[model samples]
Structures are given as C-alpha cells and as structure tokens.
Target: MTQEPKGILIVDDDQDMRELLERRLRRWDLDVVSAENGVDALEVLEREGIQLMITDWMMPEMDGLELCRAIRSRAFSRYIYIILLTGKAERHELVEGIEAGADDFIVKPFKKEELHVRIRAGMRMIQFERQKETAIQALRKKNLELEQAGATIRAHLEAAGKLQQAMLPLDVEHLGGVHFESLFVPCEYVAGDMFNYFELSDTKIAFFLLDVAGHGVPAAMQSVTISKVMNPLTLRARKAPTESSGEVKTRLLNFQDPAELAASLNRMFMGPKTGTQYFTMIYGVIDTEKNRVQFVQAGHPSLILLKSDGELKAIGEGGYPIGLLPKATYFAIELDVAPGDRIFIHSDGITDCRDANRKSFGFERLHEILSAKRQCSMRETLETIHRELISWTESATLEDDLSIVAMEFK
Candidate 1:
C-alpha cells in the first residue's frame, strides 16, 4: 500500500506563481502548503511536518536563500528539500543558492511540462536526503543503547570483584604471629585465584591458596563457591588458622591422612545445586610453634620454594582437580619451613601467561629469577618475580588472570 504524501511547503512572493505551482503539484497528489515569504514558511514549518520545500529566489523581507539557511539551522526537523526557482543563471549566484541550502535550481518562466518533470526530479533528491537522515538517526540511537549496556556490564564486574576480595583475609597485618605479604593480579577485572585464612588458635592457623583450571570471570566463580563452602566461621569453625606458609603447604599435601574433610568438601561440590565448574587448588594449615606447613594438592600448578640461603625448588606431585571426576584421590604433603624460607603458590596464568608474541612466561625462567633473587627478603623476591614476568611479555598486560601467593616463615 502506498503511504500518504507528507506535507511539502511552497514559498513565493507572487500569488500567480504560487497558484500555478500548487495546481501542478496537487495534480501529482502531494499535500502542499503555500507561504508568501520566508517568515510565513518558517511558521508553516513550525506548525507542520514538512518533508520537502520549493521557493522563489527573490522576494521582499525574506528570500529563498534566507529560507534555506533557516532550514539548515533548525536541527529538530528530519530534513527539507529546497529547490530554488531562480531567474539568474550566473555562477556566483548559483553558489549562493547552494550556500542558502538549495538542493537544486529551476529557471523561472519555464514550461509547465518542464516544471512538472523538475518537481518530480526534486522528489527523488528529497527522498534520498530523507533516507540518509533516517539512517543516521537510527545509528545514533543504537550507539547510545550499546554504550549504556557496556556501562552496566562493567559496573556488575566491579561489584563482583569487591565481593570476591571480601572473602579473603581483610587484615594482612601480623596475623597469627606470621608476617604475610601477597600480590594478586587478575588478567581481567576479576580472576580465578582464591585464598582464605581462619585463626583456629593462637598457635595454629588454617588457610588455602587455590587456582581454578582456567582464568577470568568463569574461573573466578568456582573459587567463590569453594570459599563459601570452606569458610571456617560459616562451617562452625571446622577449619584451622595459617600460622605460617609452611603449615599451609603441609596441610594441603597430607590429603590422604584425612578423607573426611576432603570427602565432605567433595559431597558439597557434587550437589546438584553447585555449578559444574572444575578447578585446580592447594589447601593448607600453618603451625606457629612447630614451624611446619601441611598442604593438600588437587591437580593444581606446583609450588615454588625459596630458601633463605638462596636455594629454590618446586613442591608437590600432581593430583586431580576439584569439581571433576567424582571419585578422584587427593593427598597431602608435609614440608619443614625454615625461618626465612618462602613458599610461593600461583595460578597457571602466571607461568603459562602469554605475551603479545604468544610466548609463555614459563617455569624455568621463573625459577632462574627466583634463584638469582633468593638472597633478598621475601617481599623483594616476590616483587622481582613480578618484574621479570612483566619484562618477558612485551605487553605487560596479562592474557589471563595472574595470581602469586607468597608466604615466608618468620
């Protein structure tokens, strides 16, 4: 079905010329409005949805040029097709016609047939301009909507990041008689690496350093669920305090000694309500008086040990990750911690992390840097690792979540 014609405005000083043009345009079945001058045309435009316009070049008070300029200034309207009916054919006058917003020119005293053909031709131009304006409006509206959607996503991510942080130890200052320092850098705004600490007693502390299988937000969600289940306060104070890093490692490696806790954790995760996301992790306990670490492994990346005497080594054999393989075995290992020895646990995002060149910041290079800087304090050693990793990747930004947990026995 053909849509009705949108109103077209016609302006001229001569009543005869206006009537003649109106009669011909009406024959083509266009709804037309006639104005005696620019002032009348502006008023007609304000009161109506004018889609096209035709005006005479010379008129007292307001001319066609003045009308076109006025049309251009009003941005609220969609578009106006202004074809000036001019007597002069001079080049300078033609340019002026263009500046005044005349889309085309039609000579005065032309044939009625020629005039009819020209107005029809003017319709084609007006339609084209209308289509362009409509497209631009649509694109602008879509762009604004997309920007708002992006902003909403970012806000949610920031809130999630803060909540995950809240699950960790809020006070890193002199907890359980062991000085603790940590550096956690996620590839995204949030990451998969998670750690938790509970003060079981003045002499004994329980904690866990975990890295899920992948990186970014998905992996981060797994850690959040585990943290929720493993919280000692929430679990009726079932967990212990992490007096030292060595204790944390010792507890993680001794998994076979107590399947009860591991089994309970397994059942909790296996519940239908829990998400089916798998993750590799290391959980542990620290004994302040004994100066020991007890830790369990669940197919996580190995631990890096830095001795006070400048010796560096890796710990724990491999095991199956959590949230995968229903009946897998998990075992714990014990390691005696020395007064200046440091144990560093991290996610794959650190070692297998890629640069712009797609090269990994591998374990061999990491050990080399550790051996070189082991003579320094635990804080300096950890920071050196951070710097070397940054230097290896041409682009310092991580492709995955980067997390490094370092604990030194005081």
Candidate 2:
C-alpha cells in the first residue's frame, strides 16, 4: 500500500505568493495546506498531519517569528520542519528567526530550484525523525519483554532454592552413640555444597560431605542428585537380596569401609556420557559397636580429629576428585575414637575462605582453633569456628559455599 503524500503548510499575508508556493509544492507530490497568518497556521497545524511549513516574514495578525514560536510550543507526534521565507538579510534577523525555532530560511525573490531543494532537505529531516521515533518505540517494547522474562527466571530460582533448603537436615541429631552437628552457608540462593549423615542400622551410621565443582543452579542440582544417592535409607533401599530359603544375605555394599564407598561412587559417577562436572568428597562410616570411624577422602580438605587429650591431627592423603577418572581408587583412614573424641569434616570452601585482606583462613589457623576448642563440646566448637570466619572476613556473606560437620564419638 502506498503512503499518503506528506502535508506542507504555507502561511503568508499575500494570497498570491502563498498560492504560488502551494502550487509548486503540490507539483512535487506534497499535500498543500495554506493559511493567511500565524493564527490560521496554528489551526491548520492542529487539524492536519503537516510535516513541513513555509511562511512569509510579514503577516497581518502574526509574523513568521511568532508562527515558528507557536508551532514549537504545541506538541506534535511528528516533527514539522520549518523554512522561513523572508527578505530580512541581516544576521540579527536570521538569528532571531532561528531563536524562534525556524529550522531553515530562504531569501525573498528566491530561485524556484533553490526553494525546491530546501523543501526536499526539510522533508528528509522529517523522514529521519520518523525513523528515529519508530526505533525508540521498538527498543522500549524489547526492554519490557526482557524485564518480564527476567522476573520469571527469578521466581524459578527462588522456588529451586526453597526446595534445596527443605532437603537439608535442619537439626542434626545423634546416630548410634555419636552426636552430629553441622553448619551450611551458601553464597547464592542455592549451594554447591551438601552434607548429611544418618543411621544405617542399629549399630552403624554413615555420613558424607561433598562440594560440587562450580556454583549456581547446575552445581546445586548436581549436589542434590549426589546427596540423594548418598542418603543411607536410599542406599539401603537399592540393595537386593539373592533368592534362598531363610537366607540372610550380607549387604554387598561395604558401608563400613569409606574407601569402598568412594570407589562405588566413582564408578557410578564416572562415564563418557557424564558431563564436565566433578566434586570433592569425604565419605565415612561410624561403627558404634567397634568404636571406630573409617572414611575416604577424594580431593577434599583433610578431616580434623580433636582427641579427648587436646591433640589435633589432620587425616587423609589428597586423592583425585570423584567423577574425574574412571579407574580412580580411594584409600580409607581408620581411627579409633573413645568417648569425647570429635571428628570434623568440611568442604574446601572453609579452608580456602578469604578475608578482607585476601588471606586464606589456612590450615595453621584451623589447627589453632581446633586445639583451643578441644575441651569444648561439638556444638560449641562449631559456633566458635563460624564466629571466627565471620570476624576474619569482616562480613557475614561468604564468597563461596561453606559446609561443616562435627561429629563427637560418645
């Protein structure tokens, strides 16, 4: 469909001059509207989609200067490019016309070709204005759509965070004769770190702490899947017994040996099909009957042992992280703990934590805290550790996910 011709308004006190200008513009495919003075020009402006104007300097009611000023005062959806036609050749008069908002000017007795060129230039400017306005409107619409999409994504992330929190063990309880306590803080709404321990049977309990390789939703989702696989009840439910009359089959999974559990998990997680993601973990089993804790380390921070006699020891030979190598093997460290002995397992986020000075809360500081809090209960020790980290960082917010599990053998 062809667009309607652009309308041009011509204002002059001389009717013959106005008609001559209007006829010239109409021949060039412009829709012409004529007015005798500034007052009449304003009425035509209000009634028509006039995009350009030509007006004489001297008019009976209002001059060209007044007409330009009045046109500028009123708001229009499109620009009305104005070219003042006048015999006023003084620099002051030209400046006055410009100050009144005349976009351009032509001298009286102007050549017809020059007038047509000036009019074409004015029309080009009006077309440019229309294009700019359309682009601005399009940009505003796109911005609104992006804002709505962002809001929807935020809501989904909030829902996922709530679900992750609900899966956590809000209050740590004793399993067998060992008392467990924990603290978990994620830098984001969802965390890449997770830890849980539960009773496997009347005389046995199992626990694990893991940190996924990265932060945000991908790591959090992976951590949740791994946590579910490590859950004691879930693991037990997956086990099956062979068919035999009145046969009591031993559990194929060696939950008593942390190295065996690590190997199993490595096999479960390692495959070509698995994406590029891995985690560091400390998996352990506490035999309440034997009074021993056996655990394996997989590229995680060392486990801290606070003995009843105020002795602090770090356990574990740093092994490769799980899911990285298909044939990765793990080694277990077995410790005999009498009553009152405590074991602390944590993610790298705690030891690698940075202070305001960019210094890490290294192993030395960790050892000092453990020795100082050796006489304190498990819960009290955890509180002290948490407090010290916050004080050192000078902020409650951590840059990474921090998780700790303190188990006291009783």
List the candidate 2 regions with Cα displacement exceeding 4 Å.
1-5, 36-48, 55-77, 89-100, 237-253, 308-310, 355-359, 365-397
Q: Estimate each model's TM-score.
A: 0.74, 0.82
lDDT winner: 2
lDDT of 2 by residue, 252-353 (tens): 556767887777667666646467378999988888998988888999999888888888889987998988987787898888989988899998777888
The TM-score obtained by model 2 is 0.82
Q: Write the per-residue lDDT of candidate 1 for residues 211-270, one digit (tens) a residue.
A: 766666777887787777677656654443222544531132222233345544554455
Candidate 1 structure, TM-score to reference: 0.74
